[model samples]
Target: MNANELTIAEARDALAGGELSAVDLTMACLTAIDAGTPLNAFVHATPEIALDQARAADARRGADAGALNGIPLGIKDLFCTKGVASQAASNILKGFKPEYESTVTSKLFEAGAVMLGKLNMDEFAMGSSNETSCYGDAVNPWKVDDRRLTPGGSSGGSAAAVAADLCLGATGTDTGGSIRQPAAFTGIVGIKPTYGRVSRWGIVAFASSLDQAGPMTKSVRDAAILLGAMAGHDPKDSTSADIPVPDFEAALTGDIRGKKIGIPREYRMDGMPAEIEALWARGREMLADAGAEIVDISLPHTKYALPAYYVIAPAEASSNLARYDGVRYGHRARLGQGDGIVDMYEKTRAEGFGKEVQRRVMIGTYVLSAGFYDAYYNRARKVRALIKRDFDEAFAAGVDAILTPATPSSAFGLGEMAEADPVAMYLNDVFTVTVNLAGLPGISVPVGLDAKGLPLGLQLIGRPWDEAGLLNHAHVLERAAGFVEKPRKWW
Candidate 1:
């Protein structure tokens, strides 16, 4: 059997049943990563580390084996893996390795998962398309009419690598739809656990409050399996919730019966594609058929979520990214003759940040500036509060979960909007950002195919800290949709 083709759960079963060895599985994935370089999914390949971990996992085979024993997975560059390059796909962090492992990654390793490598992402986790990566765009394995497509942004590499079978699953950090959007584009499952459910202790910060690390996998069951290992309260992250991590995999009972799933009217925006609307209607029908009650709800403040997200995320990013200004660590600029520290700081940041990241930092600085703080940043926070309140009200009204289309449409060609307005790219996160804003758990499950044969996903937003239920509902959706088509190996 092709080891790389096995899903995480399957690999675990195989390893436990002595049908496969972890070393063989890791080597198969490494070979696939080497062969699939055209997809540009993994920026840094860690063969030595992967093989070492796999051998150790093999040694732990019997009653000592853990839940994730012998599983091979990908880690997004955002996580600070000890001794591994943890740059957030930015030149700013060139060759920098962390001294400590991130809380999430360390936990995964303890559970016996091996890391394939660091996946590509939008530099500093900015932008909607993966075009902004300093390593260049991660080409989607899916195509339309022979034209290459984007795998979606920030976590594009994570989604692409998993979908292409380069790895069983991958870690993805979501700061306003990064995980779910790319999962939608790549036809996989990506979940953004409620804020604090997954500790953000060592993941590179984009927007402190919004940034969350989650799992992107080939199936809902795989996502649940990985999330079980990745989610936990860490004392290192003050915001980490002091809650017990549930057995997310065991929660997949396929029983969302009598659940009140809300269909928000605001998501039915003007000019929404007929395909998305149709897909959402099908989702409602699937849930209802499974005994879930579909209810129409209103999130009145939804319209302001995008603008508010832009302002608040950037504001937090500006503060979090200030550490990269040529002082303590990361890249430092070559000083000109007799150059002052101010000049060094300016030159370093100008050279370090990409165009998109720079634009956000400036916008963030501007909004946080004295005169505009109240007018822009403060108001955006208020709007964000209202958005959260909207979700809170819905949940309080007995809404068990909310359903919507994950993206406006299916994957588009890479560079399709490079010449167009940047806002056009930001609009791709329209249906996703609200979940982050409200700090709710959200999952994207591939539900159907578009006319062009690309995957389309439906999202389920759950109550805060209700990831088990969210995954249960997503599992139901996944089984009902039966979306098992893999991208043809064009890369």
Candidate 2:
């Protein structure tokens, strides 16, 4: 395979065997990123930094090389990469280069990964279709005749880059299905570890409690490799769990002889497309063929996950985003006659935040307002707890994992849903938000193609802190499905 097409593990082997150098791999990815500009996958390209790191990795060969030595990775704009413009795809933070690196990025770099630059995302990780990005919606490389589709969001660019072979893998943060949905849409693998599995320090916050960083990669094994480098506790983040890190790649034996995989009845929503149902059925058969027992289960509170997530995510977002009030770092409005600090704040925010972000912030502020707090936010929290309890009950009954469709449907055309009611866009996360709400590990694995020839993914939700097993089972399903289709590079 070409350097850009090599998966992480394959590249690692080639580098170790002296078949290729780190600089060659990094340059291949840079060339692909530059060539794939039509897809808008990467908002920033750091070829110099990537080369420097690649050289350093080559120097470290046979000395103290790390597992990720000589690997090239794309950083989703949400993760704060020091000296790189980490905007989270929002205009408000335009030109805002962080002085410190996010814990996840720092760890990856310490493991000798090279950064190709910041990938695009939804503004403040707020939208489901990546249309809310200040950089314009990231177009999925997978397309129908003359119609470009969404890569999903807010990790859309990460998905697009990986699927289009612009990068072997990328960092993606999941909040309300941002990572998994995009991975599903683009025919890649994405995993959102438990809420605290990866540190949140220095990652631009959308909803603090719900946000988690994970990996988007070409295959389940690559996801395992990247996740091993990404996961672990950090003292800097209070919410980060103080758990021991495991060798995620080593755990992928692809054997699940007696695993109980739950098929949640609530996931069978009305009007689900026939293709999605067929894909889910195929995924179940694949897993069952691999020796996993498929059991019928019910998450009774699943119906409320979307509504409750909308209320809770935005409420936290409103509080977290209040810091970017133009008085501090970020874009500030030019003052006019009679315009005081208040006017500056209003105008700067009005000009900075995109429409979907403004709408969510307003919804959040209203929900958290004194008069509405008890009625909306508090009730949503109660419902959120019930959702978690439902998953807890299922796991307590011996279900090792839950299987469902990763998305309601395959990749839709960009701006198709955004032009309609915003709620219609929110429905894209219907199968995904519950995992975020429950703070569980979930992965989207491409298993089949739909009628339009776009990929369809199956989601496997796992017990908290059990990502090793989750990835192992996903590898089993991935092998059984054996999906190897790639987008016919329109870009």
Candidate 3:
């Protein structure tokens, strides 16, 4: 097997045993990345940076080697990697390279992980499909016929890179279903750590209350390993919890016996595809086969999740994105003869932000407007509280974790819903936004494939700060399902 195709644990063992060198592993990935360029998984390829880090890792391969030593990873564009273009896949941030690295990247680097480069993402993490990215859509490696399929977004590039074995793993920030949704679409593991579980410092803000950095990898075990390095408290991010980050890899005992996995009835939406329904049923059986008791549960407020997420996410986005005017770093619009500061701000933003971003910004600004604040934003906040309460109630009732479909369907064609009503695209996040709203850890495990042979995943949402338990449950499901199919090397 190629070094790039090795899972984190596998590579770690090989590297430690002196059977493989970090330079060889990184080179294998760099080669795969070059060949995989048609997929656009990597927006920026940092070959020199990767090799330098690999050499450094080789030099430190003794007792002091860190947990993620020698792993090569693709960082999402949302992360501010010092001296690297961290555009968040938006035109506004074009040519903007941070002077400092994000807390997650810093932790990974300290753990000896190599950066392959920045991956593509949605503009300001605004869209469900990767079509909204300034770098164009990152194509899903799984294909049918000659049609291009989306890798999902806004972490589409991360998903594509990991699934195609272009890297051992990748950093992905989840705001809504950005991580899990794409992971499902690409037949990989993507976990969104509980809000504030991983420090958000240096990660470009999307929805401050909802954004979280997590790992997207080929397997649940890899996710656990990568997440371990990515997670921990940071003094810089106020929301970062001071609690300890457990050894996530050691927690994957794969014994979910006696665990109560909730099967929320609200997730069985009307008009859902038969394949998704079948996939969910198979997931339930797999867990039950693994000795987990599946109980029917209710999260009534789920019906309001999509609406609440749209309102809340966009509102936070508006507030967070206000700092990108022409006066600051990044793209600045040229001024006309009489254009003043206000005109510059307007022109810069209008020229910088993509259509989806502008739409959300406008909606956010309108909802936050004095006249409509109570009617929209405030009401959404109240609904969000109710949604969170629904999950709390389920957990209080002895549910160990909640199981649901990761997405309504498998990967769709690139432009499938782009031109449709925007609401159609929003529906893609229906199963995921609730986890973020409730501030819980959630993971998507590939369970099976649709009739079209595309992958389908089941989500496992755990109690707040219970990623260890969540990952265990997912590991059990992953083992039971035995989903070993990989996307053909079409890219």
**Which pairs of residues collide in model 3?**
none
lDDT tens digits, residue span 1-491, model 1: 58999989889888998989999999999999999999999999999999999999999998988778879899998999999999898988987899999999999998999998999999999978888888999989887687778999889999999999999999999999999999999999999999999999988999998999999999999999999999888999999999998888899999988999999999999999999999999999999999999999999999999999999999999998999988877899999899999999999999889999998999999999999999999999999999999999999999999999999989988878855888898899999999999999999999999988999999999999999999999999999999999998887
Alpha carbon lDDT at 191, candidate 1: 97
Off by over 4 Å in 1: none
Q: What is the Cα-based TM-score of model 2?
A: 0.99
Q: How accurate is candidate 1 locally (lDDT)?
A: 0.93
List, in order, the clash count of every candidate structure. 0, 0, 0
**Tens-digit lDDT track of model 2 for 1-491:** 67999999999999999999999999999999989999999999999999999999999986589889999999999999899899989889988998999999999999999999999999999988888899998999998779888999999999999999998899999998999999999999999999999999999999998999999999999999999998888999999999998999999998899999999999999999999898888888988988999999999999999999999999999999999989879899889998998899899999999999899999999999989999999999999999999999999999999999999989999868998999999999999999999999999999989888999999999999999999999999999999999999777
Candidate 3 local lDDT, 413-462, one digit each (tens):
98889989999999999999999999999999999999899999999999
Off by over 4 Å in 2: none
